[model samples]
Target chain A: MIQGISIYEILTVTTVLFFIGVYGFLTRKNLISMLISVELILNASVVNFVVINKYLYPDMLQGAVYAIFIIAVAAAETALAISIIINLYRQINSVEVKDTEVMKH
Target chain B: MDLSTFLLMRHEIVLLVVILLLIIGEVFIAESKKSSMVHLAVFLFGIHTLIGFLSIDYGSLFGGMFHTNALIQFLKNVLNIGVLILLLQSGDWLQEKIIRVNRGVEFFILLFSSLLGMYFMISAGDFLMFYLGLELSTLPVAALAAYDITKRISSESGIKLILSAALASGVSLFGISMLYATTGSIYFTEISYVITADNLTVLAFILFFTGLAFKISLVPFHFWTADVYEGAPISIASYLSVISKGAAVFILMILLFTVLKPLMHIWENMVYIIAIVTMFIGNLFALRQQNMKRFLAFSSIAQAGFILLGLITGDQLGTATVVYFLLIYIFSNLAAFGVVQAISLETGKEQMKDYEGLYRTNPNLSLIMMLALFSLAGIPPVAGFFGKFFLFTAAASKGYYLLVFLAVVNVTISLYYYLLVVRAMFLRKSDNAIPYFKSKVYMRLGLLITAIGILVIGIYSPIYDYIYELSRNLL
Candidate 1:
């Protein structure tokens, strides 16, 4: 599609990364690791935008701009998540998913 | 932006100024004197609500990335009213406990910031603006959920909230990217003109809907709701239930009705299944809730289900009913939570069992709680009944009789659990019941206003007609 690199190839890579991130998110017991998985998922979307912009809509820079905004938002989300994890750790002395079930019926 | 464009955002500008003044006051004022910040916030927000009603500007800004109309203004005003009530209800509790000393400023700051984000969200005309507003609204709430640093459940809820929100938003962003790739534009007007119901587009729509579903706490995505509601302070819990959820519903309704109108066939069917599941799961879980907050959380989830009935119709009547229902819901939910906050502040009890013989000790509060619950259960002569009636009628008009029937059955199921709380308060007797306590002026006033709203809004046809007129111009 573009200089020998196909849009479908990039999409396939992003889709795989997205699924891997979801799998890690579901399986990981540690909070920080799960946060990292979320970051992966967000980056997959970033990659998606870059690829789509570069290949499909090369006339406009809107998709690239959206990618930048997404990166900034992802950074902010990570900061908030880490702070919350630290707060939870201070209270329970653990960051494991198994230990956070304090409100179950 | 020109002066006229700036004038269109007067309510937001006013709020921004108030927040700045609050920050300035916090910096210059002494710790003891900083208590006045609550009064200042309440007064400013009250005035802002009044000004919002007078703001009749209808236009777009930032190359159609933001929109403002009578509908957005109306919703913003309603949110301001809800927030005002929240501030009033949380006054005594904050002054005495929870927000201890000078830390009250940060609580208000976080809340106002979150409200600001919701305002932007309600007006967002593009995907990027919507995503920005969504994150801005959400991240601060995680902090509010964990406001009580001393409580383990508080921080736990905060962690759960932020993690799930991150996952949901990320998934939604992926969907947005898909949509952008398909349509080559992020602006709602542009996308609406270009979108077609292709397979990839359908996938993108479903993913986007799922993300919003998490915000509205619909069914499978609702696992975090009760936990967060139970752990967060009563003020924050009510804010989550009413203000945050209300804003999300407003924006979601607009997006579905306008930008995604072409894909209504796909979404309507999806919403049909989600609504039935959400109502059933919410009511079933509510029956098992020992904690009052969790009970209300599930109850609100069920309410979200009923709201979806209107959403499925995708017509003027549906829009009117949803808007009207949210207004009634705000008053009804706040009244209930105000009572809980008062009782919890007076006595350190938060269980259903703790509410036994409540009527004998605090008849006024128990009565307010009963009225609020009656409205929520959609009993005759209360605001919730008319709200539910209109929603079902809207769906029925669309020939969705089965969905309407299921919703009625869900209403009946919901009434049982709502009555359970009433029964606990009125029928059961306990030796250690919370004694009669005099609520502060603000709490009483807040409850009284909501109680009046619960009673008056349903019986008055003018308000419903007015909302109907407003809903017609939503596009």
Candidate 2:
């Protein structure tokens, strides 16, 4: 384990951040807000990977490498999400969740 | 380091080459002949599928990051077949003036990349590889979902898919980190050795299951399905429903049966409840859908539920049955979707009311639709019946008789809604029914293949036997 910060403390802080990200996902009105919330969700896991790796297995680089991959993938996902949101804006002129209702019955 | 070792990765390597070929072909092809790219892509993919049936070594590679066995190779072939049929069915639609006039080849490249991702996913030997495969598979399809660039609904579907996908990825990653923290290893083989069913691991498993459940559209995570299907183009909708869901289910089952076997007691109960809820919710909601695409989306969810029956066994029976059922599912679902695409292409009608008196005007297409739906509904003498039968037998063998009974009930409920479509096409009459029109060669060929698959695979017993033999290595 890390010498200074307890593992529980790191995990506790991450747990809160994870829930905050989820809360933003549920409460966000605009697509951009939702997108940002998703980034937060992704980064929470990134933090968990790096912190857990540092605390538990400081010798191995596996968790650190996984964190890198997660970051790269989350970036790609955000780029696609933003492009699609822009496409939605082009056709509807609004990004609100309620405004994106061209699909339902 | 040796040349012989590369034999294990032939499927992925050849697919990568095909993707690069398409990209290069795109640049050289004349702008006026861009639509011909569809023909070239379909032809090249057909070769890839054919090559997939060839034999390859069963082993792990890349320090156990990549793994393949007979079962994984066979599933890859099944997915390749599904994608090939998808390309065939999409050929006509892609060439239409309303879509794909300029960017015709992007659809194929994106889809192939996604398929490449699935190939890695189902064959992954460790958590990190699995996560990378999952993301690669999902991101390209989000782009494809929004392929109909002119339509607001298409882009809306893309957004919904990516958002939910991002959340699912985050949730699964959290689960994986916890798992790594506990076991201090990411390799499936190693983790399985040291893993215990503690509370933290249980919580992690639940999160991981939820993430995959989103991909499979199981119950609470299924909210994005119908809306996305309704909004995306017909081809992308079918791709999501079949190829994508099949890959997710395949990987979920592999992880549960192999990597998480120690936690079977906890998860079987979870699977038991999920199977019932997913089946009921998917069927009941499907009954109300008027749009053909939306109807298929719910039906696919129900099919994913049926797949869970096989999963609960956590044995070779579960593995074999799931793979066998997915093979039949790919053919049956594609046939259904191919018919929908053909009709939607000829005329702009997508509602059930438009299908009234369909038999009177287009008897052949109606017959294909009937066959596809009957297979989907698990009627007698079709591949779907056998698929569901094996799944129930797998569940029943494990003495989950109550779960088996509930699944039977769900099958009966599903039959009702599937027959509803048949009733509209045959029993009801409308003056404005879709007029008889011929499909292009590719579309006809696609439907014909699925129709033949639906017929021949049911009575053929050897294929199921072969799958059972291959799946024996899993548990």
List the global CA lDDT of all models: 0.91, 0.91
User: Can you tell me the CAPRI class of model 2?
Assistant: high
State residue B140's C-alpha deviation in candidate 1, in Å: 0.6
Model 1 misplacement above 4 A = none
Residue pairs with clashing backbones, model 1: none
For B336-454, candidate 1 gives per-residue lDDT tens digits of 99999999988979899999999999999999999999999999889989999999999999999999999999998999999999999999999998888999999999999999999
Top candidate when judged by DockQ against the true structure: 1
State the displacement of the C-alpha of residue B354, model 1, in Å, after optimal TM-score superposition: 1.1
lDDT of 1 by residue, A4-79 (tens): 8888889999999998998999999999999999999999999999889989999998899999999998998899
TM-score of candidate 1 versus the correct structure, residues matched by position: 0.98
Per-residue lDDT of A47 in model 2: 90
